[model samples]
Target: MNKENREVVRPDGTTIHYTVTGPADGPVMALVHGWGCDRRDFDAITGFLPRHLRVLAVDLAEHGDSRSTRDVWTMEEFARDVAAVLEAESVGSCVVIGHSLGGAVAVETGRLLPGVVTRIVALDALHYLSLFPAQDECAADALLHPFREDFAGAMRGMVEAGSPPGTDPALVDAYIEKMSAVRQPAGLSALEGLVSWDMDAALRETTQPIVVFAVRAIITQEAIDRYGDRVRIETIELGSHHFHVESPEATAALLAAEMSA
Candidate 1:
């Protein structure tokens, strides 16, 4: 299908790339990809969608086809990019669906834009460890060390040891491929920015309705118990961290339902 494409210039002059599919009069739905992925990640996954909803997929600056600048990256900057896109497209009220790091960006976007965001759907992201604090977790920067000459080895180690069991082989291959494409310093800088932020305040300030679609096993039962009411925690049984990749059809269905509601 033909897709409409454009670039939105953010306040600071950074460029964010975006694409629109479906009908213009349809309900506006924004799809934001997670860390290390691009806007194209949303393609080839959706099964059935609401006929009246327009889908907008964004490539966050520095991650996809979007332009990267010299300024320091922050979730707030990411949110501004989202706002620019929404405004540029004349999207009055939108249903925002984000995955992983994009989930945090979705929250900030809703908080900053207020009534412009009707509902938010976060896929497989509860609280990113870097942005969200753990009660007893140490201040150790074990996950932030500089990449060594054996960086490839380090990534392999992380996948083998840190990833959940029975992860889809294709999913692993995709991650490795994209991650390899990124320079070491760029990856490290982005991860550092993510880990350094205090996003709890941001989440608390967001008043829009939120639906958090998290993998069943990644998030603890206690975490679910605390936020289950406002944040409806849905499970993707098969996928690991990349739940959207495993179940985009279901995710899209849930968002379509939210749009209808």
Candidate 2:
């Protein structure tokens, strides 16, 4: 399994970094990491995937090795970062897989490249009742107030909120530490972009079949009931919010199965 690291310059001058693996003509699988994380999160999963599947693991601008100076931090803009990579690689068709915030980006990517994207796979994404549903501008501001005021505390809160019962405290602390260290201003700004993103609007516009693999403990019944018709929700007992990292083999198998299906 040879992997090639590459970069694409977005129209806004931001550099989007990504890694390509597997065969050139194989079916494409675009993996997008969540907020505060990078393309490296998919390293283990990619290693476990089939050799015939072409994998494009992307680092959203300002995350991982990707660098950016643009002020616009919308999810759609992040999708453009991914679209740039696909265009550079000339990917005709792909299954976009995203985690957490990246799931929103995946939806936007599908909307942006409707003709190219075949399906959407979400790992512990799109089922948060408070986060996924459409919110009023005022409500969005209020939800982001704590993060704006105290970024560190907010990062810890996010890690803890995503951790299910029996999750190790060390793992939570590690994630908080790594996530809190995200490039200053951009890290905070990207978060603001995520909270302010209109997921309902994105879902309405993107008609791709979305398959959500949610952690059973963290997902609420309300979330499933609301988006059940639009999104296929599959509950799995896979660690915390970052279960893809905790259970890479299973996650890879799940994505492989989805791609084949």
Candidate 3:
């Protein structure tokens, strides 16, 4: 399968960068990267997907080569960016797969295009109570305090929280450094959007089946109990929260399997 880099200009003037692979008419699967990451994160995974599947790996606004002049950083707006790419490609239907913050975007995308999105897949996303289910002003302020004071430190904390025991120290360090480099204003604003996103409300509106591949090491039973009735929660003993990147082949197999399901 060949990967082709492409860009789509939304009506809002935001430009989204994405890569497409496999046959255009094949079953569609859109890949949305997590916050502080880009579409390239799915490059390897794309390679391992079934040849008959059309994969769209997207770079959300300001996250990768995508550019946007708009100010809003809500996950809904981010989903619009994904929607733009889909519209540009004339995608009739697809399974939206998101990692971390991208999972929120996936839900928003499902809500945004209810008929177009068949199912939603979350990779270590939505289960984190600290970020999901919009926080109160006080709790939101408390979370933002750390990022405002020390962005890099806050970023490191975010990565470390996702990494489990036995994970390579070098891998953790690399993720910290990469995530810490997310461009300013957008980075912080996006985090704010995530913190304030109403997961409950979104889940209430989104009717599509959502499957979450949560890391067994970090996922809490509280989260499972909270969302299991709503979404299918499968505890996967993958590397860590960013297991897709660490275990691309296995992750690809799982995604392929999900699409078939």
Query: Which candidate tops TM-score?
Result: 3
C-alpha TM-scores of all predictions = 0.87, 0.97, 0.98
Clashes of each: 4, 0, 0
Using lDDT, give the best candidate's number: 3
lDDT of 3 by residue, 1-261 (tens): 778999998755688999999998899999999999999899889989999999999999999898887889999999999999899999999999999999999999999999999999999999999899999999999999999999999889989988899888888998898889998789999999999999999999999999999999999999999999999999998797889989999999999999999
lDDT of 1 by residue, 74-178 (tens): 777788889889999999889888887788788878988998998888876654443344322244266545234455655665444325778877778767767
Best-to-worst order by lDDT is 3, 2, 1
Across 57-153, the per-residue lDDT of candidate 2 in tens digits comes to: 9999999999998999988899999999999999999999999989989999999999999999998888886666666788778778888889899
Screening candidate 1 with a backbone cut-off below 3 angstroms (N, C-alpha, C), the clashing residue pairs are 26-52, 27-52, 27-53, 130-195
For every candidate structure, what is the RMSD over all alpha carbons to the true structure, in angstroms? Answer: 2.8, 1.1, 0.8
Whole-model lDDT for model 3 versus the true structure? 0.94
